[model samples]
Target: MISDTAEYALRAVVWLVQTPDESQTTRQIAEGTRTPLDYQSKVLQLLAKSGITKSQRGTGGGIRLNVSPDGLTVLDVINAVDPIQRIHSCPLGLKEHGTCLCPMHRGLNDAVKTVEAAFKNTLVADLLKTRSKSVPLGIDLPLRAPRKPKQATA
Candidate 1:
């Protein structure tokens, strides 16, 4: 499972990719991504620190993507906020066991690898193309009511 911060980071990145306009203020980014302004600001700062996004100050300045959406992977965004930690050593801390993991841990680590692979292969651009119109990035936006069919004149 990923952290809320990571989720917010991903949403913010995806929103930026989708918009691809001028730099956006923290408030705008938070509103577009449906994340809390306070928390989103922190997430944006972390992103800027990681070089995933660039932050500007003063007039005509805000935040924008530093890396191209096509070049940026989901893993990159996730790592910016909450890196997917891998099991490197035995949890039991057995000297004889050394760095080797038990069968259970081995399986868990393998699963982690699988997840990493999926994230690595997924790009923000790809997500934009395949995202559901019903719920973008799992954030449910207000849907418009269906229009009534027009009747033929007599």
Candidate 2:
């Protein structure tokens, strides 16, 4: 499973790709991606450190994507925040298991590897090209009110 930080990073990157020519403030990116402002700021900082984004201060200055969306992959964004952890040894610390994982662990690790590979192959720009009716970040959709929970009958 991906961490919230990683998810936020992905959202930030995808959002940036939407307007590659414009520089967006942390607040704007956070609001656009539905991520927390403070958390989004930290995530952007990490991304900038990783050379995935560039930040400028003062008038008309903000954060922008440093790398091209065509060249940037989903794994690149995730790794900038929290790299996918691979199982290298026994998580349970079973002396018998050691470096060789059990069947269950091996299967889980394999599944993770599959996910990692998929992400590595997926470009951030590809998310914008989806033919689905729903758009990523809902940029093209009208805002909708949150649904209220149904009240139980007495």
Candidate 3:
């Protein structure tokens, strides 16, 4: 799973993408995205430092994206916020890890690679301009009811 920090950063980026001309205060991004204010501020700060976002500090001040949404890939956002180097490292730091995958660290690298590929391929602009190709969580199915069991070992 992607870090919650990355998820919040993407939400902030999407908010900026749709409102390219408006300076969204961190508070506004937090409230709009349902993220906690402190977390939003920290994420905003990281984005600012990374030059992905520009900040205005005085009256009527806030933040805005420096790059157009189309030019901003998910990798850009990922790097700007929660970097994934540790993700690629072996959990157990084993050398000679092979396709068989060390039992002590079975499939960990593959899991990280999957996340990297997903983030690398996605773009912030694509998020703003499109409907999700798959059903979003809490949308396609009932949220509260127990899932029905497979019938009779069909």
Task: Give Cα-based local distance difference scores for all models.
Answer: 0.82, 0.86, 0.71
4: Cα error in model 1, Å: 1.0
Q: Once superposed on the true structure, which residue ranges of model 1 sit more than 4 Å away at CA?
A: 131-154
lDDT of 1 by residue, 85-143 (tens): 99999888988767888888899999999999999999866766664665565654332
Residue 51 miss distance in model 3 (angstroms): 1.1
Candidate 1 vs 2: which has more TM-score = 2
Clashing pairs in 3: none
Error of 3 at 71 (Å): 1.6
Show model 2 residue runs off by greater than 4 Å. Answer: 141-154
Model 1's TM-score against the true structure: 0.83
Name the candidate that leads on lDDT.
Answer: 2
Lowest summed-lDDT stretch of 10 residues in model 3? 137-146
**Residue 13 miss distance in model 3 (angstroms):** 0.6
Error of 1 at 28 (Å): 0.9
Candidate 2 residues 1-154, lDDT tens each? 8999999998898787766666899999999999999999999999999999998999978988888777789999999999999999999999999999999999999999999999999987777766577888877532222223237899
Per-residue accuracy of model 3 over 107-152 as CA lDDT, tens digit each: 6656767877887887666655555556322123211211222378
